[model samples]
Target: MIIAVIDGMGGGIGGQIVNYLRQELPSYFEIYGLGTNSAATSVMLKNHANKGATGENAIVVSVKKANAIIGPLSIIIPNGMMGEVTDKMAAAVCDADAFKILLPISPENFELVGLENKPLMLLIKDAIDLLKKEFNIK
Candidate 1:
């Protein structure tokens, strides 16, 4: 399965998702770090995403080709994050039948840097468990 991690700036949330997936589920999954800008993409690349892209258009184009998408729900909001993640981004993720794994958005995390998406850690494990059970991972 190809999972795309979408993000705008910083990419902390997206990168963390990749990290968890890579460490826990490496059997047949490919993680793509999809960023709306170069900065976001750089962060994800460092986290070891199999592929990376930047810019709204670029992200829309590439993510449409991915199998699944994982990130904060805000990433797909229309004109969101200064247009870094536009409606097109949202469409691409959805049209692909890409199962979405989202991190909840809170004022504290949105305003603070490095606050981390605590729910992501929880969701990743549970999501993987469900996917594994459904697909028979082991």
Candidate 2:
């Protein structure tokens, strides 16, 4: 299966997701790191994503090829990631046929109510658990 991990800014979140997924998922699964910038892509790549791409166009094109998409909640919000995420990118992600596994992390001025404010690592672990359940992974 192809799983796309999208992120922007420092890409620390995407990097952690890539690293965790790589260690947990079967070897046959492919992880694609899609970043808003080259530096973010590089971080995901270093964390062992099978492939990497950057920018709006890359995200638009690559998301269609994925079986699942995982990232921060901001990835689907227009002008998110401090404006690094474009409307086109947000639309593309929403329109993709892939299942989305979004972390609760949001941008400034955005609030997700009723959800526990878990640490990033715990949030990521919850995402992985959801993915495993969806795919029937052991």
Candidate 3:
């Protein structure tokens, strides 16, 4: 399966997700690091993403080939990630046919109510768990 992990800014979150997923998921699953910038893509690649690409166009094209996509909820929000995510990037991700696993974490301007404010690592773990269940892994 092809899994795409998208991120922006420092790419810390995306790197962590890629690291954890690489450790937990089967090696057969291909992980693509789709970042809003080169720094972000580099981080994910260092964390073991099988492939890496950056910028809006890369994101727009890669998501189409992904079997699943995981990232912060901001990925679908226009101008999210401190304005790193563009409208086209967000629209492409939202419109992709792949299954999405978005963390509830949002930008400062947006508040996602009714959900506990968990740590970043926990949120990632929860997302990975959900993906595992969806694919019948384990």
Candidate 4:
């Protein structure tokens, strides 16, 4: 499955998603990074994204091409936090009929685990474990 992660200026969330997918999916899922700028793309590419594209159009294109998408639920709310991921991207991901595993973070969820500064590796592990039980991923 092709997995796309849409992120903002530095691709922090997107990079974490890519790393999680790589460690947990275990089937060589094609990872694509959709960054709002060059910095975001660089982060994902370094973490081993098969391909990457930048800007709004690039995100739209990834949404069109991918089989599945992953990110925070707030991504659904366009201007929620990351200006890169707009409502259109959220709608596209939802409407694409692709499997999505969104983290339970929301706009009002005041405590955010900053992907850069925090050890989200354990969080990702726990989420994937729960997802495995729910979806039987292994």
Candidate 5:
């Protein structure tokens, strides 16, 4: 399956997600690192994503081909990632047919209600668990 991990800024979150998936899941799955910038893409690539792409156009094109899309909730919010995520990128990700597994990591000036303030690592672990359950991974 083609799984896309999207992130921006320092790309820390995407890198961690890629690393966890590589270590925890079988090698049969393909991980695509989609970043708002080259720095982010490089970080995820170093963490062992099978392939990667950067910028709004790349994200718009790749998200459609993914079987699953994983990223912060901000990915679908236009002008997110400190404006690194463009409207077209947000629209494409939202409109994609792939199943979206979004992390509840809200950006500055916004907050998501009904969710406890959990550590980032814990949130990522939950995401991985959800993926495992959905795919029937051992």
Candidate 6:
């Protein structure tokens, strides 16, 4: 399956997700890192994503072929990630055919309801667990 990890800014959260997924998932599963900028893409690529692309167009085009999409919840909000994630990118990701696994990592002025303030690692683990459940992986 093709899994896409999307992120912006420093790409720290996305990098962690890619690293965990690379360690946990089988080699056959392809991980695509989509970033709002080259810096984010670089971080994810370093974490072992098979391929990576940057900018709104790259994200929009890649999401079409993704089996699953993982990233911060802010990725879906227009102008999120301090304006790194554009409206077009948010629209494409939300409308993609992939199953979205969004972390509850809130950006400034955006918060998810009923979610406790957990560590980033824990939130990422939840995302990984969701992937395992969706793919029926042990």
CA lDDT for candidate 4: 0.70
lDDT of 4 by residue, 93-113 (tens): 677665666665656545556
Tens digits of per-residue lDDT, candidate 3, 1-138, equal: 999999999999999999999999999999999999999999999999999999999999999999999999999999898899999999999999999999998798888889998999999999999999999999
Model 3: lDDT equals 0.96
Residue 81, model 6: Cα distance from true site in angstroms: 0.6
Model 2 per-residue lDDT tens digits across residues 31-57 = 999999999999999999999999999
Candidates 3 and 5 compared: the better one by TM-score is 3
Error of 3 at 133 (Å): 0.4
Q: Judged by TM-score, which candidate is best? A: 2
Comparing 3 with 4 on TM-score, the higher-scoring candidate is 3
For residues 18-119, what per-residue lDDT tens digits would candidate 1 score against the true structure? Answer: 777778776568778888888888888898888887876777777666666777767756666666667777777666666665555532235435745566
TM for candidate 1 is 0.77
Q: List pairs with backbone clashes in candidate 3.
A: none
Q: Counting only residues 3 or more apart in sequence or on different chains, how many pairs clash (N, Cα, C under 3 Å) in candidate 5?
A: 0
List all candidate RMSDs to the true structure: 4.7, 0.5, 0.6, 4.3, 0.8, 0.8
Candidate 6's displacement at residue 97, Å, is 0.9
Can you give the lDDT of residue 71 in candidate 2? Answer: 99
Q: After superposition, how far is residue 132 of candidate 6 from its true place, in Å?
A: 0.7
Candidate 5 residue lDDT tens string, 102-126? 9999989988999988998988899
Given candidate 4, what's the lDDT at residue 129?
A: 72
Quote the lDDT for 106 in model 5: 91
lDDT, candidate 6, equals 0.93
Reference-based lDDT, residue 111, model 4? 55
